[model samples]
Target chain A: MTMRSVGDGKAEFYELLPGREHVTVIEPRANPFRLDLRELWNYRDLVLLLVRRDFVAQYKQTILGPAWHIIQPLLTTLMFTIVFGKIARLPTDGLPPFLFYMAGTVIWTYFANVFTATTGTFAHNAHIFGKVYFPRLVMPLATLVSRLIAFAIQFAVFLGILAYFAVTDAAVQPNLWVLLTPVLLMMMAAIGLGGGLIVAAFTTRYRDLVVLVSFGVQLLMFATPIIYPLSSLPARWQFWASLNPIAPVVEAFRYAYLGQGTLSVGMLLLSALVVVLILSAGVVLFNTAERTFVDTV
Target chain B: MPRPVIRIENLSKYYRLGAIGSHTLREDVNRWAARLRGRPDPMPRTGAAEPETREGGGIWALKNLDLEVGAGEILGIIGPNGAGKSTLLKVLSRITAPTEGRVTMRGRVGSLLEVGTGFHPELTGRENIYLNGAILGMKTREVDRKLEAIVAFAETSQVLDTPVKRYSSGMTLRLAFAVAAHLEPEILIFDEVLAVGDRAFQDKCLDKIQDLARSGRTVLFVTHNMGPALDLCSRGIVLAAGQCAYDGTMNDAVRHYQGCAVGGRRQTR
Candidate 1:
């Protein structure tokens, strides 16, 4: 590498964005934190742009445009209401069946979408990965960002439905617990991204994991609180089910918005701890994997 | 003079070609169990030592290589395909790691291993320049300021707003090379990307590289074409069978490379 601080009008030609520095730490050796932070800051705008691309591409050429966001969950909620609520006679803890299932679906869809997309970071983008030198973590980060946008749109639809129900029915009252909604959302994103990192790290070495990841995520949805409320499960089963990381996230989400489900502070704290542990381990594994994955990938 | 911008010490990269699936796991486990029992790990068999020459099982992509590229020196790496030229660049660019060595780069390095790397098919050429530039570690404002020059250099100013997937192959290379070369990175590395476009475009790329070199940017040029390497490089390094066979002045290195090719032809005959 060479350094030329020439003043031949080259530097003057470009408008230096405020608060942005051309930071290149020429290290004697590679460091993890420095590399990741440098990449994140340098590519902040591109990250936003890629997120926009994912958001727009999903709607392009579709007749519904952004309405599909609401339509998808609405249709799924209706199907679950009929199939599980009426046919299977599944318990909904005395809460309205559509509201209960839609709440869980809203949380589960966000986690599942981010997880499935991020797990295939290596295999799906091998062509791009093979030729570029950016931080490998950027791809997964981009996936999380894009999924957040979709989740926001979907969540808006859920709110619109909830608001309609509140207006027509005297039993429903807008609750103050809605303020905790952002906290629940962060927990869901963390778990999804952390789990994705673990799967993506392993998939680089094992191609079988790629197919298994999709299947595994689908299987995990049943084990999670997606279809049934926590009160429906027996006491012993509830304890075990709550240990699943997604359980607390889903319950917290429902409790915050609908004010009808259970949210154990113990379980939520445990979920946060699990997310941190998984994210730390994933970062270590992903960093090590990034150093040598080009060969295997 | 300034310290060596790139210092490579005895770099080596080894690869294993095990049987399909996880067939080698059983033997690897057995070796681990043996080692636990105070015995040698016998799974390595014959190819474990000096792995570069093993035919059916493993091969080294680089071997015990020592090199130092000084700041502001334009060094060309010339070798035939599978001679580990790309692998070397991959290691240097931090896209891959060496098996048994370390490298210290003194400044920012940029590489264009292929035309249109990381170019989103759905993104317009203008957006792709920012995307690719950021992927190459350039800030958005830098790309914005150089936007016009990049489009002009690529000769696709009219199509800057058009999606890259709509562009021809020649146009793709034009836009990609323009963004990479004009990004003003401290070290610029090219891997045969100049082969894109017509003869005139190729010459234009060579001239651009020459200008970059004249401006005192360190460049590591990888190409099979000796003509361009000889014309642009102050020094040349030749690799053969995963090892550096020659490293000296361009004239001497080119002669050595030619001699090896003739010798290889004779051996084949």
Candidate 2:
């Protein structure tokens, strides 16, 4: 029998037969927590292609195509202006309600898209996932990247509105804190991926959870400080709302540009800590689920 | 002999077919406990289709399977329906996890389990070449290098920019096979993908598969087309009820399968 190592070294050399060395061992997942970074890195091009496919799938064969991205937020902001601004008499802290709601919508849309898209990672992609082998995480990671295209489009529109308000009334003051844009986006991505993976891991078995997700996202929107200013809430409610993790994210995003909402270093730090914990936990569950999700799904 | 590229030992994959209903919180707790104790699945039964052979309320798709293949061997796996052929391929491709045992391979493996996987009918043929190529484990630069070749080979140069939905099924398969042909994995597995195209396209695919095998790559394929299967493979495996019924030359394996079909379950017993 001949025994020799291939390449620099055999990471896992199995000699099941004489003179035969096996490099990859496929067995039941023993340790799913270890990040399979090498496998994921090799398939990085697949992730990019998947993202490109998403952009094409969105626009292909549709008459409106990219127009929908622009129109979606514009229409939603218009409704919020009418409903919350006029009918409900929600205070925008002296800033124009149109600009205020658009800001919230812009940030919220990115978060919601990332959250909802990753939530269906298992069930929606079961067909392809069952047939081929790529890092299953590639699907969700692509969603995180592809949704950025829509978010960028809407972000430009938000900046346009901010420029108008900054020049016209000076009520919406643009501060150096606006530099927090990328950081705020990262925070949302973390929570979205973390929360979505947790829910996706369970939704495979329960499935009823899948039904409640969209509705739950709406409830979460209400729970956050989206429709109302944190100052408008009662003191006790405001304290609870500040701990929402996303509350400070939304607050910081608005305060960075408008310079009027409540912003706190302690609260922001606490929220960041919570988001990190949720994301770490999400990664563990998501990794575990992807191993054998096909059999169950 | 060529060095072995794949080795499997004591491989088993059990499925809970009808017991998806017992998926309540209590069952979840039971399964978790069993796993905690390093025990086999607590569920019973071993088949979804063979209701007559229900073991312990679970279905063992591939039970205690042991297989190995040397580099450059063209293995043809011929089996009856539900004989766990696809399950074996899926396990080898790492598409799903095994319930028991281990499978080891020395080289990068690619599976053509289906043509045009992740193909959006909305996307044009030119764009889909990149998407399909990536899914099949090709790099972006690799696809770029072979773009014109793929287009010309598939005879899809005229409709390269047209959405795949507009193409006839034959054109779609040709384009898909073109991408599949260009994939350069060390180990390639196929599942009935070649028999779908027309005679001309099928011959073209057979030639490509032959070329792949000739170039020191191990190719394992599952097919029901006996004539082509026998012609393409010298060594064949006949699977019956998730077990290897016969392993030998393609001629003998087909004869064994045909004989078993006429003899029924009594022969295996």
Best TM-score goes to which candidate? 2
Write down the lDDT of every candidate, Cα atoms only: 0.77, 0.85
Give the per-residue lDDT digits (tens) of candidate 2, residues B88-142.
9999988888888888777668888998888889889988999999888888999
TM-score for predicted model 1 compared with the true structure: 0.88
Candidate 2 per-residue lDDT over residues A116-203, each given as its tens digit: 9989999899999989888788999999999998999998988998898889987889798888889889999989999999999988
**Highest-scoring model, lDDT:** 2
- Give the Å error, residue A19, model 2: 20
Q: Give per-residue lDDT, candidate 2, residue B39.
A: 96
Query: What's the residue-level lDDT of B63 in candidate 1?
Result: 85
Report the C-alpha displacement of residue B154, candidate 1, in angstroms.
Answer: 0.7
For model 1, residues A39-74, the per-residue Cα lDDT tens digits are 566677767666766765667667988787778888
Which portions of model 1 show Cα errors greater than 4 Å?
A1-35, A170-174, B1-3, B19-57
Model 2 is docked with a DockQ of 0.48
Clashing pairs in 2: B44-B56, B44-B57, B44-B58, B45-B56, B45-B57, B45-B58, B46-B58, B46-B59, B47-B59
Docking class of 1: acceptable
**CAPRI tier of model 2:** acceptable
